[model samples]
Target: MGNSQRNDGVQLQDERLRGEQLRDEQLQDEQIRLRRPAGIRSLQLGDVKVTYVPDGAIRLTPRGWLPATTDDVWAEHAAYLDETGHLVASVGGLLVEHGDRALLIDAGVGPLSVPAEPGNAVGAIEGGALLASLAEIGRDPGSIEAVAFTHLHMDHLGWAHHPAPGTDGPAFTSADYLISEPEWTHRHLAEEHGTSEEMLAALEPRVRTVNDGDEIFPGVRVMLTPGHTAGHAAYVITGGGRRLIAFGDAMHSPVQIGHPEWWATVDHDTEQSTSFRRGLVEEMSRPDTIGYGMHFADVVFGRAVRGAAGEGARWEPVDA
Candidate 1:
C-alpha cells in the first residue's frame, strides 16, 4: 500500500478500537449502577456532608408497585430489575451533618424483616443495620439532633419507633421527631398506609410539627410537597453554591425520573403526586441541584438531565 493510504488505515483502526473500549466501559458502568446494592455513600456539599445510611433493601413488583407501568415497560427496562424480576429498592435514611450537629432524614426499617407474599406490591424486605451503619461512619445515634420524616411511613419511622436491639426504648431518645404539620394532624391516615397507631404514640412526645419553608437545621429547609401522603415533605439542603433535595418517596426508583406520571400504588393522591414528581424532576435537573432518592437502589444519588427534544428527563447517577 502507498505510505499515505497505510497511515490513514492505521488511524482508522485505532479510532475503531478506542470506540469499542469506550462502549465497553460505558456498559460496565451501567451494569454496576443498575444491578448492585448501594453501600453507605457520602458526599460533600460545601461545609455540609450528606450520607445515605443504608439499613436494608426491598424488592418491588414493577407492575404492581407502579400501576401505570406495563409488562412491555419492564421488558424494555429489564436492567433495572433483578433476577427475580423485581425492581431493587434501597431502604434507608439520609444523614445530614454540619460541623458537630447531625440530622437523620428517615429512621429506616428497624430491626425487622418480612417475607415476600404472592401478588403483593413488595417482596422480601429486611432492615436493622441503620444504627450499625451510623456507628461505622462514627456518628452516635444520640448525637443526632433530630429525626425529620418525609411522611409517616413504616420504613421511614422504623428505627424511630422500634426499640434499639435488646432495649425497651427506641434509639436516639434525645432527638426530637420532626414531622410536617399536615402529616401530624392527619397522622391517623398513616395507619392505613403501614405506620401503626402504636408507632404514632411512641413518637407523640418528641414529635415537632414543622411548616413549609421552616429552616429545621443549618442550611436545611423543609419544602412540603404532599401527595405521596397527606403532608409529605422534602428537605432541601443548600451549601457551597449547590443544593441537594432529599426527595423521599416522591420517587422510589430512578426510572420514575423519566416517567413521573407513573405514581406508586402507595401515593395518597395520584394526580397530585404525579404533578409534584414532574416538577421535582425538572428542579433536580438544574445545574446546581442533586437529588437523593432513599429507595433508588444503588443509584440513590443522581441528577436529572433533559433528554432529546420531546423526551422526558432521565437520571444520571452521581458518585460520592
Candidate 2:
C-alpha cells in the first residue's frame, strides 16, 4: 500500500482510540452519578431555605457508628437502612439560602469513595456528589458568599479546599471562608482527625476567623457548641419569624436524638458531646425552632418534639 494510505490508516486508528477512551470515561462517570443520591429534598423556615444536597451516602456498622445502640434499635429503625444492612448516612452538606445570597454549612466528602475500613477506629464511608447537587439547587460554588465549616474534618472540608478538575480554583474563590476562631487556631490539631495541615494551609488565605457570638451574616449567628472538636460551632439562622440551628457534627446519628447520652466514638469529648446534645435536644424541641443535624443520616432535617407525657423528644422530618 502507498505510504500516504498507511499514514491515513494510522491517523484514523488514533482518532478511533481517543473516541473510545472518551466514551469509557463518560460511562464510568455515569455509573458514579447513578450511585449518588437525588436532589434538594428538605424544607424552608421563613426567608431561609435548607436543602440536604446529597454528596453520597456512607454505610456504617451498627456497633462502630452508634456503639450504644442495640440490635433492637437497628431493627426498629430498619426503614432508614439501605439494603446492604448497614446504617446509611446520607452524605451531603446543607445549603442555606437568604435572599439572593447563599451559604454552605459544610462541604461533603468530595468525589472519592473508600471501602469499609473495619480496622479503623471510627468506621468507614463513601461519597462525593455535593457539587452536582449544589448545581441542581441553582447555587454555584462561586455564588456561595461563604463556606462556614463547623469543624476541620476531611469529610466536611474536602470540596471546600479542593476544586474539581477543570474548575477555576477552589470553588468559593471569591467568597470569604468563615471558621470559628478556635477552630482556625487549633486547625493544626485537626490533622489527627484526618484533616491535612496542607489543606488547612491552602484555606489560610481566604479564611476569616469569627468570634463565638459574632453575627457572621444577616440573621445568622455563630454559637460555639464545642465537644466533637475543640472549636465546633453551630450556626443559628433566624429569619421569617423562625430559627434553624445548623448543628454540625454535634450528633452523628438520629438514634442520638432519642438517646442523647450515646455519643459517637469519633467525638473528641464524649462527656461534652452528651452535655451539648442534651441541651441541643431541648433547644430543638422549642416551638418555632428546627435543628439541622448535618450528619443525622436519613433524618437530617427535623424538629425535636417533646412527648406530652414528658418522654423527652423525638424528631419529625421537615419536608421541603
Candidate 3:
C-alpha cells in the first residue's frame, strides 16, 4: 500500500478503537446507575443524623404523574425511568435524630400495594419496609419522640395508622402524630385523593394539630408549603451550622427543580404548588442548604443549582 494510505488506515483504526472504548465506558456507567442502592441512606449535618428510609417504591406513569408533561418531554429524559418504563419513586420516611431524641417525618406507605390502572398516575405502589429499615438503623418504633407529618397523604401516614400484619397494634402508637392545623381542619378533602376515612379515624386519637413555624422537635420547625395539599408542610432542620429542608410532596423528584411549573397531578392547587416550588428552588440554591426529596428515587438527598434554562434550577444529589 502507498505510505499515505497506510498512515490513513492506522489513523482510522485508532479512531475506531477510541470509539469502542467510549461506548464501553458509557455502558459501564449505565450499569452502575441501574445498580444504585435503594434502601436506607444516611447523611450527617454536624450532630444531626438524617436517614432516608425505604419502605418500597411506586412506578409513576410519566404523563399521568405530571399532567403538564408531554411525550416529547419524557423523550428528552428517558434515562430517568426504570426498565419497566416507569419512574421509580421511593416511598418511605425520613428519620431525623439529634442526640438522644429522635423525630420521624412521614411514616411511609405501609404494607399495601395497588396495581396500576389505565390512566393512573402510579402504575404500582408497594411499601412494607419502614419498620424494618428503622430497625436496621438501630431505632425502635417507640424510640421516635414524635411523628411529624409533612401532609395528610396516605403514604406519609401509613406506618403510623396501619397496624403491622404480625404485630398487635399500629407502629409508633405511643408517639403523637403531628399534623398541620389547616390540614387537620380540612381533613375531609384529602379523602378524595385516596386518603381513606379509615386512616383518618385510626390516626385521629394521636393527632396533634401544629401550625406554620411550630417548633415541634429539637432543631426542626414546620414551614407551611401548601399546594400539594391544603396544608402540606416542609420541615427545616438546622444543626451544626447547616440546614436541611425535608421538603415533602412539595417536590416528588429532582427533575421538578429544573421545571417548577410541572405540578404533580395530585397537587391540590397547581398555581400554588408552582409558586412554592419556585421559592424552594431558590432556597435550595443557597450555600449550606440541602434538600430531602421524600420521593426522589435513589439519590433522595440533593441540592438545587442554577439551571441552564430560565425555568429555574436542577437538583444535584449530595453524597453527604
Candidate 4:
C-alpha cells in the first residue's frame, strides 16, 4: 500500500479510539448523576401503604458502630460492613397511609452535615430532603397528622425541627410530634451524646409525649423498645391482617439482623437495646410482617428471616 494510504488508515483508527473514549466517559458521568439520589422506597401491606424515605446516610466505624463488641465478632460480619468496617445507616423517615390520613414514623436527618469529633461514633453525614420526598409522594408535611419519633436522636428529628431551606417554617406545622414520656424527660441526655439544643428548642413546642402500648393511629401501636435511647419506640402498623414495624434505629444496619447483641455505641442503654433487639429479631422473623430499618441504605425495608443457628439470619428486601 502507498505510504499516504497507510498514514490515512492510522489517523482514522486514532480518531475512532478517541470517539469511543469520549462516549465511555460520558456514560460513566451519566451513571453517577442519574444514580438514584437515595430517597423513597414504597410498598403496600394489604390495606396499608408504607414508604421508606431517605434523609441521607452516616458512616460508623465498626469499633464505633458497636461500642462494647469485640473486633473478632464484627469480623465475622464483615461482608455486611463496608470496606472501612463502617456501617451505613439511612437517615430518613417512614410514611404510613391508610384511608385519608398520613403518619410519618420518624423525621429524617435534616438538610445538614457535620464532621465527627473524637469519641463520637457517627462520622460525616448530611440530609435535608425529607420535605421534598414527601411532596413527591403527593403528601404535604402539614398533611401528616402526627410525627412519631422512634427515639430522640437528631437524625429522627432533623427536618421536624429544622425546615428545609427557603421553606416557610417547620414543614409539619399542624402535626403533633410524638415521643415517649421518658424520652422527653431525659431529652437533655441526647445532647451529651450529640443532639443540639437548637434542635431541642425547635422541637419543644410541637413535641407531645405518649406512653407505651398507645394506639397512636388506627392499627398503629407503640412498642417501647428502649435501649438505644431511654424511650426508643417502634410502631407496628397492622391493617388487613398484615403488619410492618417501622423499627427506627433499633437495628441500624441490616447486619444487625445477624448480630442483635452488637449494639451501636450511641445506644443510651446498650444492654437494654441488645435485649430488645433479640426479641425484635424473633418478632421480625414471624409471618406476614416486615421491618423498616431507617438507616439501612438502599435496602431500607426487608424481612428478617431465621438462618442456620449461630449465623442468626439474613435480610430479604421487600419490594412491592
Candidate 5:
C-alpha cells in the first residue's frame, strides 16, 4: 500500500479509539449519578397509597454514625456506602393518601445542603423538594389535611417550617401539624439535638398533639416506638388486605434490619432504640406487611424479611 494510504488508515483508527473512550466516560458518569440519592417512589398498601417524596440525602460516616461498627464490619458490607465512602441516607417524607385527603409523614430536609465535615457523623445534607414532589403526584399542598411527625428533628421539619420555594410561607401552612404527645411535651429534648428555636416557633402555631393508637387518618394509626428520640412514632397504614408501617427513623438504613443493635450515635437512648428495632424487624417480616425506611437511599420503601438460616435477616426493596 502507498505510504499516504497507510497513514490515513492509522488516523481513522485513532479517531475510533477516542470516540470509544468518550462513550465509556459518559456511561461511568451516568452510573455515579444514579448512585447519588434523589427522586420519588411510591408503593400501595392494599387500597391506600404511600409515596416517598424526595427532598435530598445525607452521607453518614459509617463508624462515626454507628459507634459499634468497625473498619472490618464496613469492609464486609460496603455496598451500603456510596462513592464518597459514606452510608447514603436519604432525607424525605412519606405521603399517605386515601380518597381525596392526604397526610404527610415527616416534612423532609429542606433546600439547604452542606458538605461533609469533621467530628459530625452526618455528611453532605440538603433538601427542599418535598413540595415539588408532592405536586408531581398531582396533590396540592393545601389539600393535605395534616403533617404527622415521627419525631421533631431538623431534617424532618425542614419543609414544615420553611416557606415553599416560590412563596413566603410554608407549603402546608394550612395543615395541622400532628406531634406525638410525648414528643411535644418534651420538645426541649429535640432542641438540644440540632433542632433550632426558629424551627420550633414555626411549628408551634400548627402543632396538634396526637396519642399512640390515634387514628390520624383513614386506615392509619400511630404506634409509639420511641428511642431514636424521646417520643418517635411509627404510622401503620392498613387498607385493602395489606399494611405498610412507615417506621421513620427507627432504622435509618436497611442494614439496620440485620444488626439492630448498631444504633446511631445520635439516638437518644441506644438501649431502648435497639429493643424497639428488634421488635419492629420481626413485625415487618410478617406476610402482608411492608416497611418504609425514609433514610434508605434508592430504596426509600422496602420490606424487612427473615433471611435464610445462613444469611440471617436482610431487607428487600419493594418497588414504590
Candidate 6:
C-alpha cells in the first residue's frame, strides 16, 4: 500500500476505536444512573422547598411485581435491574416546607425490615432512617403540622403510627393524620393490602378526612387519583410558578412512563390504575410540572418528556 493510504487507514482505525470507547462509557454511565437507589434530594420552587427524605429501600421482582411485563421486556431494559435482577426502589417521604410550617407526604415504611420471600413480588425491604433524615435537615418531628397520606399502606404510614425509635408512642404526635375522605371511610379495605387494623385504630383519634381539592397545606391541594387503592391521592403543590405532583405509587418505576398499561400485582383495579397512569404521564410531561415517585429508585424526582413524533413519553431525571 502507498504510504499516504497507510496513514489514512491507521487514522480511520483509531477513530473507530475512540468511538467504541465513547459508546461504552456512555452505556456505563446510564447503568449507574438507573441501578442505584436515591439518597436525600431536594428542590426549591419559589417560596416552597420540597425534599425526598431517605428512609430505606426495597427490591421488586420485576416480572412478579408488574405481571404484564415479559422476560423479553426486562432483557431489553436490564439497566433498571440491580445486580440481583430486582428493581431497586427507595422508600421515603416527600417533605414540603413553606416558611416555618412543614407538611410531610407519606411517613415512609417505618422502623421495620422484611426479607424477601420466595414467590413474592417484593424482595427484601428495609426502612428506619426517616426520623434521622428529618433531624439531619434540622426539622423536628413535632414541628411538622400534618402527615398527609396517599393511602393507608404501611410504608406510607411509617412514622405516623409507629413508635419513634425507642419511644412508647407514635412520632409526629402533634400533627394531625390527614387522610383522604374515601381512604378513611374505606379503611377496612386497606387491611387486605398490608395495613393492619391496629394501625387504623391508633390513627383514629388524630385522623382528619380531607376532601378532594382541599388545600391541606399552603400551595398544596389534594388530587384524588385512585386505582392502586380505593382512595390513592396525589398531592399537588404549586409555588414559584411551577407545580409538583407527588404521585405516590401511581407509577412505581420510571419504566412505567413508557408502559402505563403494566399494572402492579398489588393494584386494586388494574384497568383503573392503567387508565390513571396514562393521564398522569401526560400531565407529568407538561413543561411546568414535576413528578415525584417515592419509589422511583435513584430518579425519585423527574419530569416526563414526550418522545420524538409518534413515540410515547420517557422520564428525564431532574437534579436537586
Residue lDDT tens for model 5, 74-147: 88877677887888888888888887889999998888878878988988887777777887989898888899
- Deviation from native of the Cα of residue 292 in model 6, angstroms: 0.3
Off by over 4 Å in 5: 1-35
lDDT of 1 by residue, 1-320 (tens): 89999999999999999999999997678666665567899889999999999899888999999999999998888878888888888988999999999999999988888999999998888888999999999999989999999999898999998989778888896899999999999989999977888999999989999999999999999999999999999999999899999999999988899899999999999998999999998899999999999999888898999999999888888885
Deviation (Å) of 119 in candidate 2: 3.7
lDDT of 6 by residue, 1-320 (tens): 99999999999999999999999986676568678778889999999999999899989999999999999999998879999999998999999999999999999988888999999998999999999999999989889989999999888898888888678888796899899998888899999878998999888999999989999999999999889998899999999888999999898899999889989998988888999999999999998999999999988888999998878788888875
Q: By lDDT, is 1 or 4 better?
A: 1
lDDT-wise, the better of 1 and 6 is 1
Q: lDDT of all predictions, in order shown? A: 0.91, 0.76, 0.85, 0.79, 0.85, 0.90
- lDDT by residue for model 2 over 257-282, one digit each (tens)? 77798777778888888899999998
Q: Cα deviation of 139 in candidate 5 (Å)?
A: 1.5
Locate the minimum summed-lDDT window of 10 residues in model 2. 30-39
Candidate 6 ranges beyond 4 A from true positions: 1-30
* lDDT minimum window of 10 residues, candidate 4: 29-38
Superposing every Cα of model 5 onto the true structure, what RMSD results?
A: 8.8
Candidate 3 contains a number of clashing pairs equal to 0
After best superposition, candidate 3 residue 33: deviation in angstroms?
A: 5.1
Best by lDDT: 1
Considering only N, C-alpha and C atoms within 3 Å, which residue pairs clash in candidate 5?
42-320, 110-127, 110-128, 111-127
Which whole-number lDDT from 0 to 100 does residue 11 have in model 4? 100
In terms of TM-score, the best-performing candidate is 1
What's the TM-score of every candidate structure?
Answer: 0.94, 0.82, 0.88, 0.83, 0.87, 0.91
- For residues 1-320, what per-residue lDDT tens digits would candidate 4 score against the true structure? 99999999999999999999999986554333222234578888767788877777787766777766677877775555655556666678888888788999988778887876666677768777777788787887778899999888877888888865667578887899999998899899899766889889888888889988899987889988888888788888887676888887788777778778878877788889889888888888988888878877667777888887666787766776
